[model samples]
Target chain A: MKPLPRIVSVLSAALIIAAAIGFLDAAYLAAKYFTGGPIACSVLDGCDTVTKSAYAVPAGIPVAVLGVMFYASVLVLALVFRERRSVTIARLLAIAGAIGFLASVWLVSVQVFILDALCLYCILSAGSSTAIFILGIAVWRLAVARANASDAAGHDSTAGRLPAVGNK
Target chain B: MSKSSIAILGVVVLAAAGLVYLGIAADGGPAAGGQAAIMTAEDHVKGNREAMVVLVEYSDFQCPACAAYYPLVKKIAEDYANDVAIVYRHFPLQQHRQAVAAAQAAEAAANQGRFWEMHDMLFEHQGEWSGNANAAELFAGYAAAIGLDGDQYRRDVEASAGRDRAQEDFQSGRAAGVNATPTFFLNGQRIVGPQSYSEFAALLDEAIAQNR
Candidate 1:
């Protein structure tokens, strides 16, 4: 029931918000993709171009659906592990964040080089994923620092205990 | 911010700037060949026949974006009547159930020498028939309104040649790397989207100046 460390709380909060934003952005695109509706793009007037590009759907699956799944998983993980005193959650988040960031980079490049257009929703998802990745890194560092502090405290009874399964 | 955070920020900024630069650069340059061969004498063309600036559009009638660009396209054809020629090609997306039918209708109307009228009517009344279950019937009404023989128009709309003509346009668009409605090729250079008239005018003006 104890409150999480300041860094952990901040990072967890940031990650959750970012993931939520990513989920909404991707979900909206996916809905429009399936329903054959027009995408409203303000930043760049190429939402339709980018969404209708060959790269938009891979293996008969809309990329926006994959994005929705990715953001949903990250959001769940962040919520469940927010107050955990272990590095496992942070490491998992970092890995997921890295994957999302890399995917965003690839998709954005497709929009740029191949499609020659920009979609505001796609950009929003990319920006949110990038923010989550950065926060994940910070969270990982904080978890490592906490673990190190615990180790240096020796057998001190007041020191925080690491989860037995994720002690590594 | 931490040094690591600052470094991450710098990397992101660099990457974003690089992407923006690449996007702009990619949008430049003339589009590849093959489009010229696709245009036949039968294609629907508007404006000056000998215009230096030729704008080819691969569009879907049922596409909202295409509808949005309809007036702008008409304006471009009007404003640059002497300097530009606009060619229409069909690129119906599979997702829109009415797109192919609409394309066939347009082609059917073309069989009676009313392609442009039907084209304008379809786009102007897109909202009325976009999701209708009987789009073909709606198209028949449009044909009648445009003064075409309704019976012949209906028969042509259902004919294989009408479908074939639309398919031909789709194939040509695919070959030209058109993946979306309202994709424009200005002077054989690709420009995507229902972009503003000013943007199109600016590019057209530049191309005209360069050609001169």
Candidate 2:
């Protein structure tokens, strides 16, 4: 088997963690909707209010479900494009993740400051997604630099060998 | 090592350390405080296991604010089930017409040994029955749907026993300095409004440690 590139390994791990966070987020919401498991919250009525709120779902789908989809897509992209053509895709994924994560943070802030409650699962998902975005950007940058250096070296070697001309 | 390589390693280590910190902080660790009485009916028999944190929730069934906070409270209950016992008092605002009846319905459900379940149901279906014309009958139907004896539930509701319980909850909430719905007393430290899980976790851990 060919050795995996260092950048691919790092990004893959980050993506997996992001996916796990998404899974947990989905589980928490589903449990509330389906089962009567006491939600884990620290604020008063925090879990119930946030989970049952309209914002809990975007476009009629649970936000947790969307989180899962987003994380899974990132993970899939990281795995499929690993090393080769990975940097560009990874950077794009990171940028998208950052936007999504920021949006979630904004929602959580509203839930706290405006709605006056805290949803533990939502917080968890937001934190994890933020970390994933950070890591994805870092890894992508590293991959790009490596690719650039190699390209530069290929040119240098070709340029170093001047065409031999017979002395006239 | 190259400067860039060092930076990469630093980022990886920092990320790893952060995850570890989060994991350790998942439950109350060194800063774990004593939680207030959050015992379920079953755990009530275990004697007053004085909780280190006391959470006071002022709620009105008809109020959208209270409905919004339902999930947040549930999360706290699950996250710190053994350590925290929340005291749910009622604070029915005047603006909501059916708030009183809904509160009463919840108390009636408590009589049937299903207060929490009915509490969740009330919040979840707040829009469906809170201020509707058929609120009384609709709420009664919910009690039945949740497996409470319909006849007994109806009698208690009509007799105002549920209403009395709700009033008592309201009185207690007022005494606790709650001017709004969903106020929290984390170890007797009062905080108002909604909070994030990370924020809660940090505060809760601090209380736990202090109590310990």
**By TM-score, who's the top model here?**
1
Off by over 4 Å in 2: A1-168, B1-50
Model 1 TM-score relative to the real fold: 0.57
lDDT of each: 0.74, 0.60
* lDDT top scorer: 1
lDDT by residue (B22-137, candidate 2, tens digit) is: 43344231221123223334221111246665555556776666665677667777787766656666677654567788878877887788777788889999768754689888
Backbone clash total, candidate 1: 0
DockQ of 2: 0.05
lDDT of 2 at A118: 60
Which residue segments of model 1 deviate by more than 4 Å? A1-168, B1-30, B36-38, B192-194
Worst 10 residues of 2 chain B by lDDT: B28-37
**A-chain TM-score, model 2:** 0.72
Summarize candidate 1's per-residue lDDT along B78-176 as a digit string, tens digits. Answer: 999999878998877765678789988988889899999999999899878877887778899999999999888878888899778888888888888
